[model samples]
Target: MGFDFLEWLNLAARWLHLITGIAWIGSSFYFVWLDNNLERPGSDAEAAGVSGQLWSVHGGGFYHNQKYPVGPGQLPRNLHWFKYEAYFTWLSGFSLLVLVYYVGARSFLIDPAKAALEVDDATALGITSLIVSWLFYHNACRLLARWPLALGIVWFGYLVGAAAFLESVFASRGAYLHVGAIIGTAMVGNVFFVIIPNQRKVVAAIKAGEAVDPKLGAQGKQRSVHNNYMTLPVLLIMISHHYPMTYGAQRPWLVLALLGATGIAIRHIFNVRHRNGPTGRWIALAVVLALVSVTYVSMEKSGAPAAQASVDPDAISFADVQPIIEQHCTSCHAEQPTSELFSEPPLGLKLENFEEVHAASTKVKQMAVDSDAMPLGNMTGMTDEERATLGAWIDAGDPE
Candidate 1:
C-alpha cells in the first residue's frame, strides 16, 4: 500500500510516450494516405491554388479535403500545428529511457559478459549514439538529396552498424532499445529541425503575400515520407524486450537488421496499396524476410546441442530445475522479489514453487532456454548447463 514513486513515474512516462507516439504516427500516416489518395482538383479549385482534392464519407458524415501543392492563397486564421505530438512523444520516450535504463543501468543496461562499463560510461555512450545517429542521418539526407535510393541504402547500413556497436557494448535488450531510441531521436529531429521550420517559413511567406518556395515543401514531404516508413520498425523495437528471441539471438545485430528490413517491406506494402499500386511483390518480400528471421532465431545456437543432448528429458524433472530457478530466476520472479531491481515479480510471474514454474514452462523455455535472455544481464551468472536442464524439464512435460 506504500507509494512506489519511481514505478509510478515509469508508468506515467511510458503511457504518455505511447499516447503521443500514436498521435504523431497516426497523423503522419493519415497525411501520407491523404497525399496518395488525392485526385486532381477541379478547374475552379485549381485556379484558387488547390492542387488536389479527395472526398470521403466516415462516421455518418462526408468530408472533403484539398491539398495545395505549396500554400493556400491566404493563410488560415486557425492553423493547427502537428509538431507538439512529435515533440512530446520524444520527450516522454526519453524520460522513460532515463528512468528504466539509465537509472537502473547495472540491472538493465550493462552486461558484464559484453563489456565492463561504469554506469556513467554506459549512459554517456547511449546518449552519444542518439546524437551521432541523428547527425549522420541528417547529413546523409542532405548530401544525397537528389539520390534517395543511395541515401536509404547508406542510412540503413549506418543503422546496422550502430546496432552492431551497441550490441557489443550493452546488454542485448539494452542494445535493442538503444537502436530504437536512435531511430526515435532521428524521427523527432526531422520534425523539430526540418519539417516544422520549413512549414513555419511557408506560413510566414503566405502571411506576407510572398511566393512560397516549393523546395521547402518538397523537403518537408521527403522527411515526412521517411518518418512514415520508419514507424513500423520503431514499433517493433519498442516491444522487442518482451520477446528475447529477437535480441537474444546469437547475432542480435543481424537479427535486428533482418527484422528491420521485414518491417520496412511491410510498410512499403501499405504505402503501395495507399497509392493504388501493385503490392504483390512487397507482400512476398515481407513474408519471406519474416520467415527467415523467425527461422534464424529458432535455429539452435552453435554449442547448444551439446549441452541440450547431455540432459536427458526422460531423466530430468521439475526438481532438477527447482534449484536453478530459485538461484537465478526467483530473485526477480517471486511474490516478494529479493532483487532491488523489482518491488514485485516481473510480469507477475512467480516461480517459487513447482506448479508456478510448470505453468510458465513455455516462457521459461523461451527466455532462459531458447535464448539466454533471462537472469537479466546474466546478473546471477546462470550457466549453459542450468538452461539446458530447464529445457530438458520442459521437454519432459514438467515432470514432478
Candidate 2:
C-alpha cells in the first residue's frame, strides 16, 4: 500500500485529539461527581477549613477527599494543573480541521447544491464562524452570569440556529463538523480565557495571604459546569462524520438539536446520580424517547418508499453499473486511488469490480442513494438518474 503524507498527518492529529479529550473529560467528570457526593465536614474538619469531604474505597484501598470552600490556610506542596489536556485537545482538533476541511475545501467543505461558494470563501466562513461563536459565548457568560439555566437554553438555541445557517452554506458533512468544532473551541476558550485565569487569581490571592475574591472562584466554577454539560454533545459531534443520517437529513439542524438535547439530558442524569437525585430515571427515559423520535424521523425522511419502482435484478448486470462506479467512486474507493489525498481505497472498500459492488450494496445505498453523502462533495457529479438506478439495483437484492 502507498502512503499519503496528509492522511498520516491526520491520523497523528486525531490520535492526540482523542487522547487529550479523554483526559480532559475524565477529570471534569470526576470533579463533578466528587462535588455532588461530598458530605458536610465534622466539627474538627470544619475548624481546619474543610467544608465538605468524601470517603470511598477503590482498588482495595480507602480514599478520603476534602474540599475547602475557599483556599486552605496554606497551599499544598504539589499541585497538578488540568489545563494542558484542554489546550492540547483543542490544538490537535483544530489541526485536524484545517488539514481535512480547509486544505480540501473543494471536495470536503463546499456543497454547490447548498451554496455557490469558492473554496476560499467556504474556508473563510468556517473559520469566521468559530471565532464569532466564541465571542458570543464569552459575552453571554458574562452578561447572563446570574442565570445559568437561562443562559444554557439561549446558547442551545444559538447552536441550533447556527446549524441551520451552516447547513445552508456548507456541505452537510462540513456543516455538522463545523458545529462540533465551534463547541470544542468554546470549551477550550473557557479554560484558557476564563477558567484558568480566574483560578490563577484565586490561587495568587491565597498564596499572598490575602482573602481570595469569591467571585473569581465562582466564575471559574460556572464555566467548569458548562464544560461538563457540553462534553457529551461535543463527543457526538466529533464522531458525526461517520454517520450520514445525522448530518444528511433535510433538516439536519433539527436533527442536531434533538440529538444534542438527548446528550445533555443523559449527562444530567449522570451528574445527579451519585446524589440520589430523583430525576435520573426521568432523564434516561427522555433520552430513549428522543433517540426513538430522531431515528423514526430520519428513516421516514430518507429511506426509500416501499412503492419505489422495482427492477429485475437479473437485467441489472455488473456491466451496466461499472461505468458509473468508475466515474464517481473509484477515485477514492479503488485499490490504488488516483486521488492524491488517499493512499489507498477509503475504508478498504475497492469498487473496481462487480463483486466489490455487490459486497458494498448496503453502504452504497446508505451513503450514495439515500443520503447523497458519497462522492465526497459530489466531486464526480453523479447524476440523479445514476442514483435512481443504483437504488433500484440495491432494492432488488443486488442479483449477480
Candidate 3:
C-alpha cells in the first residue's frame, strides 16, 4: 500500500490532535486563573452557597463568574463539559502514534544499537509501558495524597527513571515519544477516571438533593493540580521528537530530566504569578539559566571528541566517503529516495553528488558522527565504523 494515503490520514489526525489539545489547555489555564483570582463573595452570594466570585472583561464585555464548593443550590439549565477536547486529543494522538511508529515500527521504533527488539516486541512494550505507567501514577497519587512534597519527588523521580528505561529500549525519537505517550496517557486517565467521575458524582448528588461528598471534590481538585503541573513538561516531551539534540544525546535520559525540570520550573513561575506570588521572577530567571545549561550540556555530550585524530584533507577524497553515504544515507537523502516513505529528499536535503554532500557536511557529521540519529532507526545498516569514517571525512574538509 502507498504511504501517501497513510501520510494524509496521519496529517489529519495530528491536526485534530493539536486543535483539541489547544482547546483543552486553554480551558485548563482559564479555570486555574479563575480559581486563583476569585474573591470571597459577599453576604448575599455566601447565603446562596457561592464560595467565590470573579469579575473580568473579555471581547469588549464585562463578565462575572461564581464558584460553589458543592452546587449553586441547583444545577444550571445548560452545562458545558470540557471533556471531549481531552478525550479527542488523546484519541487522535494515540492514532497518530500507531500510524507513524507502530505501523512503521522498523523504521521509527527500534534501534538495534539501543536494543535488539523485534517489531512485535517493541509494539507490546510501548502499549504495556503506557498502561503500567498510568497504573503506577494513579496509585502513587493515592498513596502520597497527604504529602505533596513526597508525591512530587516520586513523580519527578519516576520520569527520570522512565526516561532512562525508554532510552535503553528504543531509538532516540521512539524513546522520547514513548515517554510523552505515557505522560499523555496519565493526563487523559486523570480526566477520565478521576476528574470527570468525581464531577459527575457531585452533579448527581446535587440533583438528588443529598449531601455531596467533599472528598470527591477534593480528589478532583488534586488531579487537576497534577494535570496543571504536568502541562509544561508534557509539552516539552511532545515537541522533543523534532529536535535531535534532545533525543539524540549520549545520555538522553539526563537531557530529558534537565529539560523537564526547566519546563516545570517555568511552569511554577507562571502558576505563582497567577496567584500574585513574589517568587515567580526568581523562578523564571532560574529557568532561563537552566535552559542555557541544558543547551551547553547537550552539545558537549552529543559531540564527544573522537578518539582518533582528524584525517588529513589532502589525503582524503570524496570516493572514500561516497560509498558510505550512498550505501546508508542517500536512500532517504537523495533527489529520489529509494524508500517508499519519501517523495523527495527529507528536509529538502539531497546528497546525490559530491557538491551536495560537501554543502551539507556539517549536518551529515551531526547526524552520523555526533549521533546515530540518521538512517532512521539505522534501517540502512549503517555501521559505527562507517559513521566514524564519515566524521573523519567531514573533519578533513570534504576533499574532492
- Model 1: how far residue 227 lies from native, Å: 0.2
lDDT of 3 by residue, 323-361 (tens): 888898888887778887776787899998999999999
Per-candidate TM vs. native?
0.97, 0.94, 0.92
Find the candidate with the highest TM-score and give its number. Answer: 1
Candidate models: Cα lDDT each: 0.91, 0.86, 0.84
Tens-digit per-residue lDDT, 1-400, candidate 1: 4578999999999999999998999999999999999999899999999989999999999999999879898877898889999999999999989999999999899999889999999999999999999999999999999998898899899999999999999999999999999999999999999999999999999999999999999999999999988899999999999888889888999999999999999989988998999999999999999999988776746544546534567888776778888899998898888898889988899999989998998999999988888888898998888887888888878899
**TM-score order of candidates, top first:** 1, 2, 3
| TM-score of candidate 2 to 2 decimals | 0.94
Q: What is the lDDT ranking, best to worst?
A: 1, 2, 3
> What does candidate 1 score on TM?
0.97
Winner by lDDT: 1
